[model samples]
Target: MTKITYVTTHGERIDTEAENGATVMETAIMNAVPGIVAECGGACTCATCHVYIDDAWRETVGGPSSMEEDMLDFAFDVKDSSRLSCQIKVRDALDGLVVHVPSRQG
Candidate 1:
């Protein structure tokens, strides 16, 4: 399982284990991490699962795809590090991934 950490807007840290091929959003929902609303259920239609990729993990996580970027337009407080958790797939390389949840969803 890949280990993922979610730092909430309130400064709460939630750690979770995710299977390979699972999306970060899926893991967040499964682990009951607050702040990842996932309103569209990973469909890339909504940005409720928006998160900020930690600087250390940016290259590994990569930038959002064009489609994802377009969808992210609806997210709150969009930033250069902003991403939709549903677009981030878990893998061995992402074993220590860390993400930050926004204060609110779009």
Candidate 2:
């Protein structure tokens, strides 16, 4: 398992453990960590799972696909650091991953 810390836009922080292979949003929703709605269930078709991966761990995360990028355009407060959590597969490399959720999402 990995310890993923989620910080909401209002600065609320939630720390939880997640199975190594689970997508970041899956963990959040399962734990009810708040901020991630995951409206499309990790299909990369919804921006409701939008998150900003911590800068320190950015290099460790996989890049977004064209579909994820296109959908991200619809998220609240979209930024360069934004990512669709459903697109990030957790693993050993992401054990200490931290992401910030925007204040709003579907």
The models' CA-based lDDT, in order, is 0.95, 0.88
Could you give candidate 2's per-residue lDDT for residues 1-106 as a string of tens digits?
A: 7999999877888889999889999999998977789988988888999999889988789668888889987888887888999989889889888999888984
Residue 64 lDDT in candidate 1? 97
> How well does candidate 1 score on lDDT at residue 94?
97
Give RMSD (Å) of candidate 2 vs. truth: 1.2
Q: In model 1, where do residues sit more than 4 Å from their true spots?
A: none
Per-residue lDDT, model 2, residue 27, is 96
52: Cα error in model 2, Å: 0.4
lDDT of 1 by residue, 1-106 (tens): 8999999988988989999999999999999999989988999999999999999999999999999999988999999999999999999999889999999998
Best by TM-score: 1
Go through the candidates in order and give the clash count of each. 0, 0
Which candidate's lDDT is highest?
A: 1
* Weakest 10 consecutive residues of candidate 1 by summed lDDT: 8-17
Off by over 4 Å in 2: none
